[model samples]
Target: MRFRDGQWLVAEGVRIEYAEEVYRITPTPSGKGISLLCPTRKVMSRGDTLNLGTLSIDIEAAFDGVISVETTHWQGAIRRGPDFDLFPAGRPDVDAKITKTEAGTTVSAGGLSATVSGKPHEFDVSFHPTAGGKPLTTLLNRSVGLAYTPAPSSPMQLADTRIFKHYLFTQTTLSVGESIHGLGERFGPFNKVGQKVDLWNSDGGTSSDQAYKNISFWMSSRGYGVFIDTPERVELEIGSERCCRVQTSVEGQRLRWYLIYGPTPRDVLRRYSVLTGAPGRVPSWSFGLWLSTSFTTSYDEETVNTFLSGMKARDIPVEVFHFDCFWLKAFQWCDFEFDKDMFPDPQGQITRLKADGVVKKVCVWTNPYLGQASPVFAEAAAKGYLLKRKNGDVFQWDLWQTGMGIVDFTNPAACAWFVSCLERLFDTGVDCIKTDFGERIPSEDVQWFDSSVDPKRMHNYYTFVYNKLVYETLQKRYGTDEAVLFARSATAGSQRFPLTWGGDCESTPEAMAESLRGGLSLGLSGFAFWSVDIGGFEGYPPPWIYKRWVAFGLLCSHSRLHGSNSYRVPWTVDDDDQSDEGCSATLRKWTHLKARLMPYLFSQAQACVGAGLPLSLRAMCIEFPDDPTAWSLDRQFMLGDSLLVAPVFEEDGTVQFYLPEGSWTNFFTHEVKNGPGWFTETHKFGTLPLYVRPNTLLVLGKEGEKRTVYDYASDVEVRSYYAREGASAILVDNQGNKLGKLEVKNGEVVGSEVLTGEFRITVVNA
Candidate 1:
């Protein structure tokens, strides 16, 4: 994807040409539109026009508040099927106004205005914020083009694409001092300014550059966001391939990009979420801890009971109990039936677990892959419910399971067949399903149910369709507010399904840091809730590493205990370790803290669902973009716009984190510090750098409550920090009822209505 070696030279064996001259412009018959014959060379008299279908540009403000720029090469090619449903599907049609002047033609849509460079030197499509004072942002000045490799005369040459090697690419400048922030689940760094991110979802673990969820979108520090409206492998060179430009390329004839405007980065995400769908309302109890019988580890009904009983005996509360892969018989995955050997009476066991009071929520792992040994595989093949190749054969693979055929969610009958499996699980007392392995979709010569679908596009968009089927399945059965899934794969709009987790992280400090970065990046990308493996998914973690990660996991929007070869139960691992002398005690401490704070967490989550506030679980940069220092700090994050958390990533529990321009109050010690700078501190396993920003109000349940589900308004405490004039907070209970409001005037905290539920209030440095 990197074409340039430096500022002045292109890489070896690489050839790229850009659009230069505009020959003619034709208007669309329906709306205000202009299509230009933009070739790769300057048209001087008629001698320079030899090659055709090299490049063309279409400029239109088809939808209100959206500017659509489509650049094409090899025009009039047959279109493939699996493209993203962009602004056209969900928004109203607004007539764009075109005004021609000597300067250029301006197409105005709402407050956004686009000026196309005209006549003598046809070059740019520049945009301005006419409504606000925000500066200009350009889509492409002269960077739209086709890039390809010439067939080599040398023997070392390799074939690139079966179709013509030409691909569509566009580049736009990033202003001086501007920071770019997304391309989802990127674990390498916080600022994506100098990163080459290929939007390919792969199973390469968290230690590498590969990501599980690759959404082709980015938000800028300049108060706007850009979404490349294509699902075919979008290669993003953010100030990396070519300096000062975010170069986006896709392997296709046409490329579509949406330029979204907002006065702030948070507002940009708010508008972006409207283009795609917003996050759904997750269940209130999903905020509590989840314990799983780790993948590849042996487990049965006795093992499940012991894990549940162990947490209860230690006073560590768990809400969701997850059964990993072996819950179904080995190699017969997605049988949708619990292994009779492990669970003799599956329905009875689920009913017992829910009634036992220790574990009230239950989940099972399910993927779309149907194994050959499964009872329903033959039936599915007979019914044509499996994905097929162009040769009319089932595309079976032997990677995770022997002879596994993928379910074609795109087929309506296949979806009903898959939904029936889920209904069978729900017929028992299963509460949730962890939708996994949708990322390893095929991009070969595979045929989809929709005959016009493109395989390359479905490689990423497959997860969206897979997750949507199950999310709708749950919403239809359980109602909108009660549905949730512990999903492991996603795309641009897949955030509509709540609660996705970072997949396959190792048990190390470096992986822990990357997991946090991935979560923060996903939050900024538009997801409301996320989680990761508690200790990790790989090998057994060191005692100190396990203890540190537990604290970090408990603070995420969702929490689950899982691993690959080892169980993540604190006491089980602590039995053989020398480090983390208080491992069990530390796990208990954090679990109890998350349970008591469910009132505060659930309140913020509900508000985000009702009003489109871009998910409360956020990176500090998204919450405090005004502070330049916060833009580059990836090790820490701000929860719900008020609480700041710096997870200790070292074995000794020492971290250096920034507190952006505020009087930050530590959540544990209630110690207030004035910042806009960095602080270095060492903490025990029980404490990390969690802070509450100045002039905010936090509603918390009772300090020592053991159960996760409770009347949040009852016996609650409202904590006020640096409460000054005009600073106010409203308390909403778990059931979406307004409890009371708190206001501060002249450095005194006052209740608006003598707060009916849990009148206990604490003021910190007010």
Candidate 2:
């Protein structure tokens, strides 16, 4: 991935051909783009072009505020399948024009423009605002080229004797003080400087540089973003290979990317959603507390009922109950049959729970792989629905399950077969699914049912297909607005699936903060809804830690309590079982608070889906792009446009958070503070710092609301926080239908005719 050793040296056995001169520039056939032919060397004589390599570069407008640049070494390479499904909603029309002058050729689309220098012996592509300002980024001389590993001795080498791999790469300039973010659920540093990020989904937990969701997009602090348009592995050296440039390299002959101009980070995200797709809308009931039977824990129908009953005894409502991997018999994962020994009647249990109002939904764990021990595996293999090797044998691995073969979603019959499996689950009273473990897809020496797909490309793209198929099936069964999925792995367009959670993490404070970082990174990458295991996933969280994480997790857009070796039920995890301020009490308080806040939260969720913004745990940088300190803070996040949540990471409940220049009102204490500075505070297990921004209207549902599904328009409290005269809150019903708006008029809160709720208005800091 890194071809250069330093400023002036190439890595050993790596051959590089740097584009040195722009030999020719012509308009594209569409007349909306420019094409360039750049030779590796400056041609001083007519014969100098005879035996030199030339890089073909094309520049076009993908949409408004987005420009595409594709560089290729060989034009004859066959294009493969498994490509990204860009513009899934449909492409927008753009006003693109080409202008050629004596200096260069500039292609302008919307307000973005790219100018390529026409001077001989010089190669430069400068991207800037069409209205004219500082350039966003530039590709200088020797920045675009082809690289070969284990360099061939000569050009005349025979094809059978040659043993080498070639790569196409591009390096773009990074402005001073610029930081890069969002390579998909990254858990390392908040900023991606001095890091070599390989875009491949992995099963690595929260402490490693590897990520579970490896998206190919990164937003820069300099008001622009770059999206590598490939499903294959893309290695990015962000100021690591070259101190002043971000280098992107991919195996094969071609590499393409989109340069999106935002003037603002939020604008950049809005444009990105248009290019890929906006995040899907999740059901409103999913916003409440979800209790799961922890992985590897001894859980049966009795244990599940006991946990739900325990929560009910403590005044905590479990909106959704999930059964983790042990739901099926051991060694038979995708057989889709409940373990009869554990639960004699699985469907009856779900029915009883829902019938008794104990839980609203039931979710079960599944993956794209079927174990050989499963009877369904033999059926799938006989039906040619499993991935096969070149010799036509079913591919098998023992990493997660013995002889697990991946379901070949590339085949239509295989997809239908999987759909039938899901239909059976749906018929058995399962409401949703926990689609897990698509990150470990094998791409070596394997043959897909669709032979046109490159194995390497299918590695990360596998999650997209796997999740999309399941999501569509859910939408077909449930209504579009009623579908939800707790998926683990993802690629670029996987945001189209409703919800995804941060994968396995330790039960330490550091892991909690890292999980927040991962959610922030993913939020910046265009994902709308994200969650974390309430008390971490690997081990038992201490009472204080569990209490603290309960507050944090419940505040996420989607909350789920799950763990690996131990149950995450609050009563079981709390050390002081008799104390009133224990984990169970904390869980109860936060769950009720989320239910009360649903009026505002659901409205904000609707806005996020419409605008391509993250619903919960949004990075401060996205909302406060002008604040330099906001870009570096990852421990704290803005829950929506109004509230800022700083989770207490220390065992003593100490937390430090920043508020941009504004008057912030504490939601709990009702105390107001003016800040453009850092504030540290210590809280008990019951509460943390939750602040309301200035000039905002905060809405709340009925007090002591138990269930998440309710008439949000009825029995609501509208709180005003030193808001301007025009400040308002948009209201929606339990079914996500727009009702009306409540606004301030004549110094009083007034509602439109459609706002038929019993409104109680209170001014917090007015």
Winning model by lDDT: 2
> What would the per-residue lDDT of candidate 2 be over residues 1-766, giving only the tens digit for each residue?
7998899999999889998988998877777798899999989999998987999999997778899999988898899978999998999998998888888989988989999987767999999999989999999989999988887778765264347888999999998999999989999999998999999999999999999999999999999999999999999999999989999999999999999999898899999999989999998899989999999999899999999988888889999999999999999987789999999999999999999888889999999989899888888999999999989999998988899999999999999999999999999999899999899888788999999999999999999999999999999999888889999999999999979999999999999999999999999999999999999999888888888899999899999999999999987886538566878778888999999999999999999998888988799999899899999999999998999999999987788989898999999998887889999999997789999999898888877776788888777777899988999889888777888888888888777565455767788878
Provide the RMSD of all predictions against the true structure, rounded to 1 decimal: 3.1, 1.2
Q: What are the TM-scores, per candidate, against the unseen true structure? A: 0.94, 0.99
10 residues in a row with least lDDT, candidate 2? 153-162
* C-alpha lDDT score of every prediction, in listed order: 0.81, 0.91
- Candidate 1 C-alpha lDDT tens digits along 43-90: 777666764334677777755666677888766678887777553237
Model 2 spans > 4 angstroms off: 158-162
Candidate 1 ranges beyond 4 A from true positions: 3-15, 24-33, 46-54, 62-65, 87-89, 92-95, 131-136, 139-141, 151-163, 576-581, 610-617, 737-740, 745-754
